[model samples]
Target: MLSILEKFDIFGVPIKLKTIKKQEQFKSSQSGVIAIIIMILSLAYFFYVISLWINGKLIPKVTTSQRMIDYTTYEWENSEISFTLYDIRSKINPFTKENNIIMPVLLEISGLIISAYPRLLFSTLQVDGDKNVITIDKGKLVLSQVDGSKEDDQEDIKQYFVFFTKCRQDWMEEGGYCADQQTIDDYFSTNHGLLFLSINLQQYNYETLEFDEIKKTQFFAFEEKSPFYSQVVLQKQQTTIDDGILFSNFKTFEVIKDYEVNTQAVSAKFAQDTVITVDNIQLEFESLGAFIFRIDNIQANETILMPKLGEVLAQIGSIVNIIMLLKILSNMINTAMLESTILHQIIEIYYPQFQHVQITKNFLGQIKQVHYKGVEIKLANFQHKYNQLLEIARTKFTFNNLIQEISRVQLVLINQIGIQNIKNIFKIEEDLKFFESDRLSNSNHQIQNLVSVLPEESPKKSEFERFELFNSEFPS
Candidate 1:
C-alpha cells in the first residue's frame, strides 16, 4: 500500500519543481507539404487517365477489308530527325538575382526548322563526335525513282518537337518546375528504323551568363509528299533545368522519294586512298556526310550527244565541193555530146533524110552554107534540147540549194546545244542549292568543317567558261 501510494503521489506539488523538455527535441515537417504532394499525385493520376483515354480512342473498330502496307526500312546518313538545345541561367546565387533561368532557345527555333525530305540516296559527312563514331554498312549508289504510289511515303515526312519532361513531383520537391532536355529519338516505324539525336556536350553553353538568341530562322526544303513522326526531349547533363520553351509558327511538311533535276553531281572517293584505282575522274562524296542521295557516276562521254559543229560543217562543205566538182566533170565529159548530139539525134529522128541531105556554105575560099532544118549535122550548141527538163532539174534539185538546206540543220543543232547546256547547268545549280541547304539544316551533318559547291557557277567556271564564248563545249 505504501509503495503504490508513493508511485501515484503528487510529487511536484511545488510549481518550481515542474519542468518541460526543449522545443527542439520534437521533429516536424515543412508547412503545406502534404497538400502539395497529394495535389501532385492527383495530377499524375489525371495525366495517366488521359493517356489511357487517348489509347482507347485509337483502338480500331471492327472492319473487314483488304489492305496492304509495305513494310520497309531505310538507313539514311546523318538524318537528324530531332534536336533540342537550351539556354540556361540558373539562380545559382539567389541573392544575385541570377535565377537559374533556362532560356529555351530551341523552343523558339523549332518552328523555323523546315524538314528537308530524304533523298533516294545519301552521302555521309564524316565527323568525330569525340565519344562516338558511325561506320556505314553499304555504299553503293543505286536508286530508282521515288514512290509511284498514291499515298506519300511515311518515313520521309518532316516534323519537329522540343520538350522537357521532368518529375513535376521531383521538381516540386526541389522547389522547381523545369527539367533539362537532353535527348531526342525518332521512331520512323519498323521499316525505316529509329534515329536518335543526342546533344554534344561540347556544344553546350555551360557558363551562360547571357543567351545568344537564335533569330532569323527559316524552313529547309523537303519533298512535297511524305509522312513521318517526330519527338523532342530535354534531358539533364549534370545540371538542373526549369521551365518549358514555347514554339511558334510551324507548318506540316511532306517528302518525295524520286525528285528529278535536269543536272546532278555526285562525288565519291575511295576509302583511305586505296592501292587500286577503279576510276579517278569521279569525285567521291560518299565519305563526307549524310546524303539523301548520291548522283550516279555519270558517263560524260555517253551524254555528249552533240558533235563538234565545226567538224560537221567542214564535212558538209566537202560534200558540197564534191557535188560541184562532179557536176563540172559531167559537163566536161559530154560537153559536145550534150549540145550537138541532141541536135543531131533530134534531126535524124524527126527527118531521116536530114542525115544525107546537107547544104554546106564554106568559108572565104569556098561557098559554105549551114545545114537546113532536115540536115542531120552536128553543131557546137544544140537548141533542140529539152529545155523544160533542164529547168526542172536546176530549179527543183540543185546541189547548191540542197547544201543550203542541210546547213540549216547544223545551225539548229548548235542552237539546241547552247540552250540545252544552259538548262543543264542551271538545273545543276538548283539541285546544288537544295543539297547545300539540306546539309546545313541537318543537325547531324557536320558541315562546319567542309566546303560545298556553291549554288552558282564555280569560281573557275564562272571566270573562264562564261567568257570562253567560242568554246566547242558551249556551242554558240
Candidate 2:
C-alpha cells in the first residue's frame, strides 16, 4: 500500500491537504465504506487502464525500436570458468519458409562446478557447417583468477537466474514437468540448429555497461564486419591423431568410446595422454562422482576421458526421456496444452494477471484476416505499424539486478555513451516486480501482442520516440 502510494506521485500533482482532511473527517461515516470501495475499484481500474495504455499507446509509438535480433537468447554457467557462447542464425529448412527458429536454446541446465584442468567442459554441440556436424572453436577468458588456483571449487551455484525456459515455465505455471512422451531424442543434438555456449562461464554480462572513467578496451558488436564471429563448440568425443586413431578427451562418465590402450602407456604425463592407455585394469576410474561409465574396447587397454558428474546424469536422463517420448509419439499423442519446448507454436497465449488467456499467435494472426459481422474490429486496420510495434517489443526491457560485474561493465557502456540522460519514471523495484509478475514464466504471460492501441495524435505514435539517436555520434 505504501509503495502504491509512492507511485501515485509520479502522476505529477498530489491531492491537496484540504481534501485529505475532509476525507479523514468523513472516515467514521457509513458512506466512508462505500467511498473506500469506490476508491479501491478506481485504483484497480487505473492500473488496468495503464496496462492497456502502455500496450496500446506507448508500444505503437516505438516501431523500428523493436526488430533487433536476439541472437544470445539464453545463458548458463558460473563466473569462474572460461566460457565462449556461440549461436547460428539460418533457415531451418530451405524449402519451408517457417521452419526457422533463431536458436534452439538451452534454457535450463545444471552441470558440475568443480574445475577439471585440460578436460573439456560438458558442452553443447555445434553445427560443423551449414551441415549437422558440430564444431569446436575458441574465444576469450574473463575475470582472471587472482591466485590462479584451478582448485577453487564452488559447491553452490552463486545465484544464477533461469529465463525463457520451457522446463522452468512448465515447473512453475503447470506445477510439474510436462509428462508427455516428448522425449529427449527429439530435442538434443540434431539438425535442430542449436546455439551452443561452451559454458565455462563465470560472468554472464548480457547488458551494456556504463563507467565513470573512459575505460578503454577493444570490443565489437555481433554485427557483421565485427571481427569476433559466433563459433560452434562441439560435444567432446574422439579425434584421430597424427600417429594412430586416438580418443579426444576421454571420459568414462557421460560418454564411452572404445579404443586400443597403449598398454605401455605410463599415465603419469597425464596431460599428454587421453585415457588409462596402459593395459592395466579393465576400466579406469577417470574421475569421481555418484556414478561411473566406461567405454569397452574390442581391443584391450584403450584409454578414455572421464566426464563430469552432472553431464553423466543429464545424459542418462536424456536417454530415458527420449525412449519414453518416442513411445508416446508413436501413439500419435499430443500433450494438449502441456508444456512445450516449441513455444514458437503456442497460439493461445497466457498474459499477465489477466488469467488463462487463450491467445495464440496463429489465432491472432488469423484474427487480422478475420472479418466480424457484429463489430468493426479488423486486424488489417493496424497491420503495418502494429507489426513494427511487436518488433520493437523484442528489444528486451531488461531489469538486471546490479551484480558487481554488471555494475562495472554497464557503467563503462551506459555511462561512456551518456545513457544517464534517460529519465526513467518507474522505480527499478516497481518495474522489476511488474516484470516478475508479467513477462517471465508466470502462467498468465501472453506473447505480447504489441498492436496499436493509441490514436494518431499520441506522442508515442512516432516510430522511434523513446530511444536515443544512434551512436553514430562516436569519434570518427
Candidate 3:
C-alpha cells in the first residue's frame, strides 16, 4: 500500500492502476473469447469439407441409371462364321510335322446361312487360354429354323459341310469342299490330349469380299426388339477311335448359356440384293462376365450429381480461412507477450525494499514485521531519481558500489526468468556494461594500494617555495 503523500507516476506520467487492470482484463477476456470462437468456426468448416469427401466416396446412392439405345445394322449377305483348329501341346502340325504351323484346319463359311441362322455346330472344340476364344477342329453342320427350333438333317444341308481355307485359295473352287473321313482324321489329332477350336461370328461383305462398315456392337439394349449376341463356349466331350488306339478329346461348342436371342422379332428385308436390318446385338465378353451394354435406336439419358463449382471453390477457400485464423492467433500471442514485457518493465522500474518494523503482540508473542515495499517516490515526487535509473540502464558501471544490488538480483533472477524477458523488464540497453564483482574488487584494491603509496600529509610550503613551484608548473 502506498501512502497518500507518496507520488505514483511513471516517467512523469500518472497511471490509474486499478482502472488499467480492470480495463486490461476486460480486453484480454474479450480477445480470448473472440479468438476461440473464430478457431471453432474454422474447425467446423474444415469438418464440413471432410464430410463432403466422405459422402462422395462412401455413398453409392448418389449414382444415377439411364436408358440408352444402339442403332446398328446387320447385313445378312456380308456376315461370316470362321472355324480355326489349333494343336495346343505342339508348335508343329501333328500330321504334317511342320514347325510354327499348329493350325491343321482352317474353315470359313460366308453366305446368308451364318448370318440368318441362330444355331451352328462344330464337332470338336477346345478353349485357347492365350486367345481367349473357343476353337473348332472339325464340325457337323446343323441349322436352325426361323422359329428357334432345329431342322432335321437333309442331304443339301450336309453338302454345305465345306473346308474353306482362305489362305489356300487353290484347294478347290468356291474356297472349300466337303471333307472325307480320311482327311478329317489326318488333320486333327489329339495324341497329346491337347487340341483347340475357335469360331468367330462376324459381319463381312461377300460381294466385295472385304470388310464392311465397323459399327458398335451392343452388349445390352434398352428395347426388347434389339438382338443380343453372345460369344460361344466349349463343353467337354470325348471320342475314341479303334478301341482307344486313337482318341480325341473334345468340348462341345456352345454359346453363352441363359442368353436370349431377340433377333427373331426383327423383320428381315431384302434391298438391292443385300439383307439389311437395324438390330441390337451383344458381343460376348470373356473376363469381366458382365457387359457394359449398348442401347439400340435411342440415345442414352445421363444424370450426374456432384458438388457445384462454387462449393468446391469455397471448400478450397477454407484453407485461406485457416491461415487467417492462425495469423490472428499469432498476433494475439505477440500482443500478450509485448504487454507482459511492458508490465514487467514498469514494475521493475520501482526499486523493491525489505524493512523490519515492530508489531503489536499477537496471541503467541510480540512479532517483528517484515514488509516488502517498492520505491516510495515516483517521477513527480523526485524527477531526478527516475532520471538516475534511466541513466543507469543506458550507461556502463564504472564503480563496484554502483552495481552491487542489480548484480546480485540479476544472478538470482536469471534462472527464474528468460534473459530476454528480464532484460526487457529492466529496460536494459545493449550498451550497458557489467563487470564481475571479484574483478571490480581487485581493481579497487589496486587503486587503494596506489593511493596508499602517497605521503599521509603534504609537507608545509613557504610562500616563496609555493611561488617557485607555481612558476615551474606554469611559465607566465
Tens digit of per-residue lDDT, candidate 2, span 1-476 = 98889877766765544422454221223334444555565556556544543343211111111122111112223221122223254322211112211111111111222222122122233323433222123322111122333434422121111111112222222222332234322332333332222222111111221111121111112221111222122122222111111334322211111112111212222211222222322211211001111112121122322233343345445554544454443223223211121131221121121122132334113422322223223344334433443443333222343355477775654443345322221212332455654545533222221112224434343443332211121111
lDDT of each: 0.29, 0.26, 0.32
- Candidate maximizing lDDT: 3
Better of 1 and 2 by lDDT: 1
Question: What lDDT tens digits, residue by residue, belong to model 1 across residues 247-311?
Answer: 22222211111222121222223211221123323212212111122222111110111123343
Model 3 ranges with Cα > 4 A deviation: 1-62, 68-87, 90-183, 186-315, 319-325, 348-476
In terms of lDDT, model 1 sits at 0.29
Point out where model 1 deviates above 4 Å. Answer: 1-313, 325-334, 337-476
Quote model 1's TM-score: 0.15
TM agreement with the true structure for every prediction: 0.15, 0.13, 0.25
lDDT per residue (tens digit) for residues 338-379 in model 3: 454343354354322111111232432223231123212222
Worst 10 residues of 1 by lDDT: 297-306
Tell me how many residue pairs clash in candidate 2.
Answer: 45
